[model samples]
Target chain A: MSLTTDDVNKIAYLARLGINAKDTASYTENLSDMLKLVEQMSSIDTDNVTPMAHPLDTIQRLRPDKIIEDNQRDHFQSIAPQTEEGLYLVPKVLD
Target chain B: MTMHTKTLKQLSQGLQTGEYSSQELTLAYLNRIQQYSALNSFISVTEAQAIAAAKQADALLTAGNAPLLTGIPMAHKDIFCTQGVKTSCGSKMLDNFIAPYNATVVDNLNAAGMVSLGKLNMDEFAMGSSNETSFYGTAYNPWADNTVPGGSSGGSAAAVAARLIPAATGTDTGGSIRQPAAFCGITGLKPTYGRVSRYGMIAYASSLDQGGPMTQTAEDAALMLQAMAGFDPKDSTSAQQDVPNYSTNLNNSLQDLKIGLPKEFFDEGLNNDMATAIETAVNEYKQMGAEIIEVSMPHLKLAIPAYYVIAPAECSANLQRMDGVRFGHRCDNPEDLNDLYIRSRGEGFGTEVKRRILVGTYALSAGYYDAHYIKAQKIRRLITEDFTKALESVDVIMGPVTPTPAFGIGEKTADPIEMYLADIYTIAINLAGLPAMSIPAGFIDNKPVGLQIIGNYFAEAKLLNVAHQYQQVTNWHQQTPKGFE
Candidate 1:
């Protein structure tokens, strides 16, 4: 299986990680090598197989919807890369 | 005696009788940690925090109300979140990351009066078989300075093995805890899925990641598990069933016990020394009156394959939250929104982590879901069924933790496939949602080999009982690294 530079960029795009043209060669080889390993899955016959999303088949249990934590904003935002007014600041995405 | 030689119960008793204050015990562990600093076992030591907590625990002991682990010192695998402490997860991406809240495991340990010693190093995002992938550097095997301590919980295992700390918490996604414990010659357990809460443990294949204890003995692992286990509303998948006293059956006799030896586990690739040591241990069990049975988990070959698909797919999704926007690392220059996402993640994650993300993204993509992801999930069911059937005829399944003992630091780090193969015998337990433990069985060429015990769903007590009984008759777990002390 061969992944082109375009494919690597597309996968990165979908994954929400940016990758440029120059890094594509290394990404291509790595991704292709990984796919070859993953290809081993194709050999196993999985007909009528039920996908297990969770190890246990139990449904989500509801909680009391109570606020058990308090006064953690200052403690939490203190670690953010960029923050102000109890919120994290990020690069502008708007026009 | 080394502070690490004492079990949780023994330490609790000492605290109760005023034999030693928590502060003194904390200082002893701190001194040992300093003595073994060359091992690179601890990433960050919270000395002030640990002493303060120990003082509080001493006050509780003075009041005759000491908890199960009151004043006992413990270490956390780097993956677990500790409020106001650096949580690198052995990755450069989170090098500067400081968790805002304590992980559920950390919270529970503190509640039980256990003092935090420090954060232990791990594989980058808990992704490797050896600790070499750690961005900080590889943790030295305290047993042999030239070799690696198994990973991604290598540091925790080393700390316990070197007698630096009594025990430490570890998270096993795909054999992280067990492999390291086996390599470092300590006991480590990964409870049945949902038995321990994962609220603050940094996500690594959320479906497979589980937090458990790595300690010098099975009984100590039980006490640590008792405080760490049980349901938490914060973790949706936590089992609602009552947690039994894990120590309740610790000293039980293994007579009439049925131990299953998986034939597939003894396949061609297994190292002869490991095989011999394991067989000797099994013979000891037989001599002790436990019956041995040959059990087959036919789909064993598919475990490694299925895990690669499912774990990476889940990891791809779990790690997306680490982008620069919310917290952690960010790029210096951001041309646009996309550039911020690209530069931050591209520069933050290591090569192996990025590779897994790409693979996972490819597996979960629309065209590949049924062919790759769904197929792996289907094979996963068969893997679980194999265990269910094997357990029906046997009380517990026993096998080699890894095909061989710990390899050189960089031996398997470059080859992803070889690294994946290291977890062949252990990943099935995670897929099946069963509790399993790794205990020191014997040595192979002076390196420790672990005997794996797999129990039915939520059978941690029985598993510990089997391990404790074996430990009573054997002294493998007591052998410490000679020069480290």
Candidate 2:
């Protein structure tokens, strides 16, 4: 269950985090230790046991379709890092 | 007694009897915060806002319209959103971000006329077992200078223990609230999942994360929980059940109380001194005509493994919203959207947070979802079943809140596995979605030991009653940290 440097890099990339080359060794070591801890779960028998996502085992409670919150887009967008003309601005994804 | 030394209940009485004004009380606490600044307990102090709120509370008191919490001052863990104030969540990611609205708990406490002193420090995004992971810096244990106040609600516990505030709000995902409460020698409750609305609290692990009260006594916790609990339409997961009057049962006799001792909790991991303190607390309960039964949770050993997977998996999803565009920390310059996300998250988050995100992402990654995430979920079901079967014959379960008392600040940080093990005794209850609390039972080697009392779902009142009855005869809860007094 030891994570290689490549695996650490992949995980960081998947998580949308950029790890410097210097930290990769520590990340691999730390993540490998964590995975080793998680490896213990494989020894337990979970045969026929249902996977419990929510503790209560309840589904999301749906509300009637209605407008509950008043429009506060401007107020909400006030904290945005970059915004222009009522839209959030991000680095271009399309050329 | 000065306002800082008084318990929430006493402070409430003082305000009611006109012995002191809320403004005066608020100023006294603010002064204490200044004097105890070395503890690093608070991240933000809203002195002006606190004074203004105190004035409004005073007006309410004069009008005879004050609630029980009126004029009482407290601090909130930075995890809960506070409008117009920085809710840092102890991470640089949100250090400059001001909450646009109040968390439901904050709103409810405010509506009850309680004055908030400010935002307290915590483990970054409530991730670590010790407060050392906070972006603001580690919060020192008020009881001892070099030791850590157990976290991720470390500051909440430290501030209350230091008498800087009578009580503070804390959220427990695994053991954040209770462990810190134990470490700082105070009372903390983590109510059943959905018992308190989680509307604006920053999400870590949505299923296991629950907000509760951290105070000097169970009675104070009861008062705080009364104000904080209730269904909120905004939070769909909030339970629709009626919030019970937790204070009403505090004086109930412990006669015939069937307490179960989980054998696994007393096994190899528990420190010998902690075991003795927990055993002494159990004997006290036995002397009160309570019946103690031994229960087995064989799969308890699997809790740490299961929690690591499930919590991280959920955390990865929840924290996805923290991407640089809408809010939170954004990088200085970005060549592309991918670069923005990668650098913003990498630079903005602390080491622990980044580690968890990486772990979570790997657990939920395309090729590994079933082997890791699904298997962890199945193990979670087994752990929950263990509690269900044990609770069938017992009124509540009792154990050590943590494997040992508070350790040195940097003791477990070097090894993530060791830090993860610190939460072993407290994680299963979260997995079970049950109500549990930690009360100051005794001290070992000058550090505090907490006796963990666990109850069935929606059984907060019962848990409070159990802890309250114990506090009635013991002086442990009354012992304040030295010099801070």
Best by DockQ: 2
The per-residue C-alpha lDDT of model 2 at residue B151 equals 96
The TM-scores, chain A only, for the candidates as listed are 0.80, 0.94
Q: Best candidate, lDDT-wise?
A: 2
lDDT of 1 by residue, B351-390 (tens): 7788789889988999989888988889889999899999
Cα lDDT for residue B335, model 2? 93
- Where model 1 places Cα greater than 4 Å from the true spot, the runs are A18-26, A64-74
Q: What is the TM-score of each candidate against the true structure?
A: 0.97, 0.99
Score each candidate by Cα lDDT.
0.88, 0.94
Chain A only: give the TM-score of model 2.
Answer: 0.94
- Local accuracy of candidate 2 as per-residue lDDT tens digits, B149-210: 99999999999999999999999999999999999999999999999999999999999999
Tens-digit per-residue lDDT, A10-70, candidate 2 = 8888889888899999999999999999999999778799999888877789999999889
Per-residue error at B123 for model 1, in Å? Answer: 1.0
